[model samples]
Target: MGEGRLFESIGRALGLPPEAVARFGVDGPAEAAVLVETALRASGFRTDVTLYIDASRARALTSVEVATRVAPLLGEEVLVSPPADDPAVATSWFLITPGGERFRAREASPGNDSDCVEIDRASLRPG
Candidate 1:
């Protein structure tokens, strides 16, 4: 799915239209955090959401986040599984950067549970 479509889908699930999503206030990181927190909760995530502004990738201040309800593993030595939600409709995690850029997280390797490579920006495509 395209970015617009992805967020539109998410917006629908969130009962937030495109205008509402944009109205979450995106002028700064504080605003971004509010936007993200609201989205995650509406998506049925009960775990803590952590946000990070990563400039290490492609020299851009990307809003990298991890939904503990989704990708909970913190070490390569542990094995994990996705929550009991359909990945087809509900995304495991979300990435939103400046410029209203958004992406859905996908596993780098489907069966490989180990490593920090599980969820990667490189794994993100249009959606």
Candidate 2:
């Protein structure tokens, strides 16, 4: 490959597209995350994602199962209810914070920014 062509290929591999990325807030971050996940997959970059969750068993059949079921199809590592002290994971999970009308719904059951759980995968407990 020509040196110039090699550089262009590298840029593409590294995700330097001309189109600016879109950002969403905490609300409906799922949809945005899905987009980012798609881009990452297209670019061949493996990623691990986390989400904010609670200890309530009641929520198990709800988002918990829903997100887990969604991950394999999307090909992502997902976690829920991460540590509040870790800023890296804390920031990682908020892939999209939907705004306007979407943000309105997010406010109702706000996902904790501090928690570091995976958004679309289930946690496997060790015996």
* Model 1, span 89-117: residue lDDT tens: 34354544333344566545445433233
TM-score, structure 1 vs. true: 0.25
- The number of the candidate with the highest TM-score is 1
**Model 2 over residues 1-127: C-alpha lDDT tens digits?**
2323322322232333312212223553342211121112221122332323223311234333433443343334333332356454433332221111111011112245322222321312220
Model 1 accuracy (lDDT, Cα): 0.34
Residue 75 displacement (Å), model 2: 2.1
**Residue pairs with backbone overlap in model 1:** none
The total of clashing pairs for model 2 equals 19
Question: Candidate 2 at 67: error in angstroms?
Answer: 2.0
Provide the overall lDDT of each model, using Cα atoms, as 2-decimal numbers: 0.34, 0.28
Q: What's each prediction's TM-score? A: 0.25, 0.22
